[model samples]
Target: MTDTDVAPDTAAWRTPHGTSQSVSQNHLAGEVWMLLRRNIREALRSPVIAFIFPVLFPLFAETLVASSYARVSSLESFPIQPYTAYMAPGMMLLAGMMGSGYSATALVLDVQTGFLQRLRLLNVRPSAILLSRIIFDALRVLPAAVVVLLVGLALGARLESGPASVVGLLVMCSAWSVAYGGLFYIVALTTWNPQAPLAMSPLFILLMFTSTAAMPTSLQPGWLASLAHYNPFTYVTEGARALMTGPVTAHALLPAAAVLVVGIALTQGFVIPLFRRAVER
Candidate 1:
């Protein structure tokens, strides 16, 4: 049996060193820590998934697109000088979104291998696995997000808001990534089909292009502008841009925060039940 499968000593449990509830909580915490470490190691082992695609690919795309569109910012209607500055925040967000597929696919592999079933047999709490996966997925984006931002800086994207805004920007990206990734998790759990999440993966590209990611809403065509106005990603991108660039105000950040809160509440509300049902089967 694996380390996770080895139960704590029964005699130790009977001792009064700790209350049963406290001991159980400690046990769950240990399990989560171990699982999280495993997940992180797995991610690091695959550099393509862990870094290249999420970091380099987005940076490349941003660089190419921003270069081609650099002159767009010279228009009187545009506010930012270099197009890369306008695109950087959205590209960083894109880096986070791109990694969601791997996270969902990893969960599918665990299901196919009966790992979750084994954990269940060991009396591991579902919450432990869920928390570990969620935390891992949230963390998986940070390195890529930071790299993309740094690349943008090299490409002449200025962070007018100063150093402290970096924290806020990363936090916004992480929150949005978690909330966005929950959809893939729900699909993976519900269908138990590894291809399901990957199949719908184009939605990430679609959402990014349909939002204010490529250009400010004012420059978009009327139909596209209207669509972007309703896209949740628009708020996220706008908020992230505000943090990185300027206009650090509630009017800029509140809508994004609200959208993230609601999205997390809705998606995670479904993910838990779906995950429980999938593992039990």
Candidate 2:
């Protein structure tokens, strides 16, 4: 079985007590998995908060946005498919962003409660600590991933790229969630406040609306269309919608990853060092 599949505490039985430099790669990996699993468990501990809520939030968002355009045949007089189908991919990305908040909240707790200090005493690898929490946060978001896709499928969303697109979409969503989650965690670590990251909530929501999220840019006013065209989330939504309509090609997928790449590049410079300092403190 993989390290994640086993009991997390079992690592306590296997990890050799020694300096971080002396630890084998495999053992370090095991430690990372242990911490990753722990974070997942912590995040998912509340059923209402973790399970039912994530599943329902996407459905709620889709209905609300879809309802707004219900009376209109099409926004720009373009050939409009079902509103559900048009809105699904954007809703999925929004859900991923919402689900990432729990990771930041948990990190804030770690900072405030001195749990990070204990980890530093253990001599854990800084990368392992940060990456594991971020990866686990992505895992914790699986309910959103599955429930949103299922809702879309039921509402006439099709995977036009076939089986491959199914896997590709999941990978894309996971990457986006991890990158943003890591960014949120960094904000919490630096502020050392559980509520500091909440300020980001409005910014992200605005980004979603200003993009080609609910309606295509052609439907928007000239100014809004211009603004949406420049938004990174526009590319992300277009990339995802392409997977549902046509082919999962490099041309279709690269823009989706570009936002994530920029997120990682910008956040990595800050998150890793910030996390290290938090541990050192």
Candidate 3:
């Protein structure tokens, strides 16, 4: 139909996919918000929610770990922490890492579908494409975060500092999610492969395994031990654990924040260029 045949509100108003929407003035934030909102809504829908493997998988893993460790009644004799309490932060990080696959795959799909191209013509900001993916992934992980936290609590995980600590940890996780997700999006856009994000699992798993997530760094040996020292996951896990367990200190928070900032810096460095290329294409 011609523009004259459509309502004024409908005319020139369109979603990034060329669908009808109540379009108005364009700005970077608005564009990002639209993309983020669309992503979240679609994610919550049926069947597609299969993408929630990140959140659900962590809960299952945490439960199994807690159970397996529980079998060793000797675990309680440890002077350190209870099994549940120690595993909570690790599970939280796992969820965040897993959920990021959605954003990466979505970025690749957008590239394949020419969605990014359409957005460019509308004068959408180059950064917005990448930024939206980061923001959306962070928000998308919230439900999984909540599920993991609740599962940890159910499994007898204690949050010594109460609500404030939980909130602080969540904020930190969200930031990390954004940073990590941005990196995934960069790879997705560069490779133009939706499966690229799937390949990320083994790498992140290796990182988590080598880090202090599953055990304290003290037990590690040789180069395996060295990875624990520099791995971002280790700092993030310890930082989050500190927040939940009380006595938040620069010792914990600073290193975590530094890793997150460094990761973000690296992701943005590549994403900005990839986004520019997307726009130019």
Best-fitting candidate, scored by lDDT: 1
**Which segments of candidate 3 are over 4 A away from where they belong?**
1-24, 45-51, 71-79
> What is the C-alpha lDDT profile of model 3 across 16-132, one tens digit per residue?
797655323567787777767656655665224424677766787688866776544345344236667777887887777885767677666666666665566556676766677
What is the Cα-based TM-score of model 2? Answer: 0.85
Task: State the lDDT of candidate 2 residue by residue for 1-281, as single tens digits.
Answer: 23342334334434366323322344678768867867766655656655566556578867776767754535457434677777888777766677555667777676666565545555667677787876776666666877898878887667777867766667667777777677677778777877877666556677787998777877789999999988877888878888776656788678778887897677767887887777776
Q: Which candidate's TM-score is highest?
A: 1
RMSD for each model, in Å, please? 4.4, 4.7, 4.8
Per-model TM values vs. the true structure = 0.89, 0.85, 0.85
- The CA root-mean-square deviation of candidate 2, after full C-alpha superposition on the true structure, stands at 4.7
Q: List, in order, the clash count of every candidate structure.
A: 0, 0, 0
lDDT values, one for every candidate: 0.82, 0.70, 0.72
**Model 1 Cα lDDT, one tens digit per residue, 1-281:** 23342233212233466544333445777878877877876777687866677776678778887899889999999978788999999998888888687888888888776677656655667898899998887888898899999989998988899999999888887888899999999888878788888787678888898998889888999999999999999999999999988888899899989999999999999998888888777
Clashing pairs in model 3? Answer: none
- Which window of 10 residues has the lowest lDDT sum in candidate 2? 1-10
Summed over model 3, clashes come to 0
